[model samples]
Target: MSRSKWTNIIFLIVILLLIIPQTRLPIQVALHKLITKVNSIRVLEEDNSVRITDTNWQLKSEKGLLKNLNQSEGKVIVINFWATWCAPCIAEMPSLQSLYDAYNNKVDFLFITTDDFKKVSYFKNKNEYSFPVYQPYSQPPNVLMTKSIPRTVVINAEGEIVIDESGAVDWFSEKVQSELNKLLK
Candidate 1:
């Protein structure tokens, strides 16, 4: 074969390598970690009644129901918006699960998704994720109705939006965990 044909073959391989999921996921994750910076700051402890997290949620399974954020007042709350079809969401889920595992007892982790129950269930079971997933029984606070997927809003015990990120985040990062710990204190 000519050198041009060999070059064309190599180009096609490179394109296919980038197009395939298994080959592309790691590259995307690396790029995200390189560009996404987590800021460290103490969350305000001031009292506020904004309550954008004032929505009711039903557990994805038959486990139970979350009354409302009002009932969860005085507790550190994590409300994450994700979808089963989102690649970045899927990529970040393991870290979310790790965060859940570490703080599940101390934090109210609500993995809220607007996707259908069937799709959510399939995704959960396929991935074997232990984190609690829910569908909103009522609309979330206006601050959360975002156009982006994998949005995360961390409400300190004082009901402040301490960390409101629009894209996938490394929830188990040291800085994020420190902020969460500060909220508990």
Candidate 2:
């Protein structure tokens, strides 16, 4: 093949490679921005009077035994479904503990782990958290029909599932505090 032809082909391939990502750059940026906006806006029900039914799911407390969360009535219950392997779950744990310490008596904070009782026991011993910890039954919670990790559900005093967020969230954010405050009130 002629050198010019070869040069032209190479140039065309280079141009295509460069142009493709550039062409998609705008879409990628827009999608990223959209995701940021969506995550920033917390979706919560405006009507705060809805009450959640008693799920009666058994959860293990920090003491390494099964306990029922439904017994803690007339208080805000924050049930965090986390696993020891989840980085986000570990990162937000301190914040959850802080929140629990601030309102442990007034509100019930349950850190429900799907991990086996042995692993949970080791983790609890390694890191001492003041909040109550529990292991959900081998099955997932009724409210959270799915077995996805890092799910945080905020049940109000009336047992209504107020905030059912799946994935890592800024639990310490003003939005979360506001929601918790509203529930407390």
Candidate 3:
């Protein structure tokens, strides 16, 4: 077969794979993980960043505990808005898990989702992720609200948003670690 013909065949195969539900999810997640390798998450400048002044946010933990966002005030927080069915969110879970493992004691990590608690608990256990998962019990402040999944915001102790990134990201990357370390200090 000619090279062009081979390319066409490969493209057709990919299209077919994407059309299949079971195969499509994993393929999309893999593609997103690949994308994160090249896409770096940056910290925003102080003047350009938004302060999280409203701490009235309410969330329920996976363990059935009601938690208030105000509890994290004066502490570094990594808040991620994600859903169980989101491919990009699944893709970034490993990196987020790794980050949580390293900073759990020093930083407050909130993995917020609108999905059912049962499904979220199952997913967390299946993936062996130890990060705390929460469902928004009440509306969050405007700064914490997003239309998309896998939206992550890192806020320093002073309540300023340092890194607000959407979509998939390698949370365990050195650049992210360096930024978090700076915030911790």
Candidate 4:
């Protein structure tokens, strides 16, 4: 096909996708998930291979209580930024849950929400998601704060951002397990 013809075909598809919102969203979401999975595997590396200075980010307390974001200081830490109302976030929770179940003993998983406390609690209960949930008590480190979510950040024992991306990802994939296993070692 000629380059001009291909460009016009692509433009028409995009226009149609925009005109009919429902048709394109699912395809876009599927593409995002696939890209996330593929890129995650391509970039997987051992924890010891990377390091960064301590961010020293603390979670805000609720009812005079605080969370131990630092508890897994010497272990793999997976923090997911999500909200109850976010469809993509909800769609990816099951995979996150599976990932947590497999590595709960070796890695720390935190599902940090920026939604109302009651809503989060109810959503968690309703969904039967068991990962520890919290909202930022104060402003998080700049690296953690972003305009878009469900951004997931993986920090190794040495505190490096192993994988930082914004999209719904399949956390329980075998390749992901292979990568996390290296971090645990």
Candidate 5:
């Protein structure tokens, strides 16, 4: 082959090498499978500690008294702090709702929204979600002052803050259910 033809062939080969991985369905599937496997392995190696604290704080729920959270004695209270703008928060809400339905009487599922009361009302009205929605004023209650959406604070029946994590977590996970069961007992 002439030098120019050879160069053109090499360029085409390089382009194919780069484009094939992105364009090929099998390659994408394999990559997704690998990622899933890696994530599962990491989760298996995670610690199972239920982080809790005695921090005294309050939050403003549309339902009035913040003390209502304290009233759910002897029940597992899953306090999920989220906002409408957060995609993960919106994604995990349905799962949270399902979990709530499963344990409605056994657990107190409080879905707290940190967005403006107007926005929260609009979103809740639009979605027709029956979960208790709350909005903290300019100065949120101490318990919810963290200002981080998608933070879930699991509290035991005794009103003690259990697992306080700042991210979207699978509320219906076996691990979480198991922990809640322990507290219920």
Candidate 6:
């Protein structure tokens, strides 16, 4: 077959695959994962960074306990807003889990989602991820507000939003580790 014919055939196959829900999801997740593998989260410059004016946000733990963000004041915090149905969120979860494994003790990691705890728990168990997940009990601070899922924000001990990313990224990258270490010190 000619190159153009082969290209047209491949394009048609992709289109047909996307028309089916079952096949579409996996393809979308795979594409998202590929994007994340190549992309590293970028830290905002000091001037461009936003400061959290309030730490009074409330979060409900997976265990049904209410926790205050104020408790993490003066500590490095990783807050990810994601949903179980979000393909990009699912794609980046493994990297987030790896990052959590390495920094859970030293940093505050909050995998915030709007999904019911039951569903979130099922997803976590199925993926064998042990990261702490929470539901927002109240409105998050304005600086942390986002209109999209899979948004992640990293706040330093000094309360500066150093990293605010709105899509999937390799959370376990060397740059992320270095940034977290710097924030810790």
lDDT of 6 by residue, 1-185 (tens): 89999999999999999999999888999999999988888889999988888999999999999999999999999999999989999999999999999999999999999998889999999999999889999998888888998999999998999999988899999999999999999
Question: In terms of TM-score, which candidate is strongest?
Answer: 3
Report the lDDT tens digits of candidate 4 across residue range 114-153.
6887787787789797777777876676667778878888
The regions of model 3 sitting more than 4 angstroms off are: none
Off by over 4 Å in 1: 1-11, 17-66
Model 3: worst 10 consecutive residues (lDDT sum): 33-42
Q: Candidate 5, residue 109: CA error in Å?
A: 2.4
Q: Estimate each model's TM-score.
A: 0.75, 0.67, 0.98, 0.72, 0.59, 0.96
Candidates' RMSD to native: 4.4, 9.2, 0.8, 5.1, 8.9, 1.0
Tens digit per residue, CA lDDT, model 1, 38-127: 522234344533444454433443254555657667889998889887767876787788899999999998888878877877888998
Q: Record all residue pairs in model 6 with backbone atoms less than 3 Å apart, i.e. clashing.
A: none
Pairwise TM-score winner, candidates 5 and 6: 6
What TM-score, to 2 decimals, does candidate 5 have? 0.59
Over 1-185, each residue of candidate 5 has an lDDT whose tens digit, in order, gives 89999999998876686588544443443443343233311121125533233333455777565644434556677778788776556656665776777788888777776578788778778876667775543443466456666777776665556677665456666766777777788
Worst 10 residues of 6 by lDDT: 140-149
lDDT against the true structure, each candidate: 0.74, 0.68, 0.94, 0.74, 0.62, 0.93
CA lDDT, candidate 5, residue 65:
55
Candidate 4, residue 68: the lDDT equals: 57
Residue-wise lDDT of candidate 2 within 35-66, one digit each (tens)? 43345325457584346564667776656677
Whole-model alpha-carbon lDDT for candidate 5: 0.62
Query: What are the runs in model 2 whose C-alpha is more than 4 Å off?
Result: 1-43, 47-50, 138-141
Candidate 1 has which clashing residue pairs, if any? none
Candidate 3: residue 35 lDDT (0-100) = 80
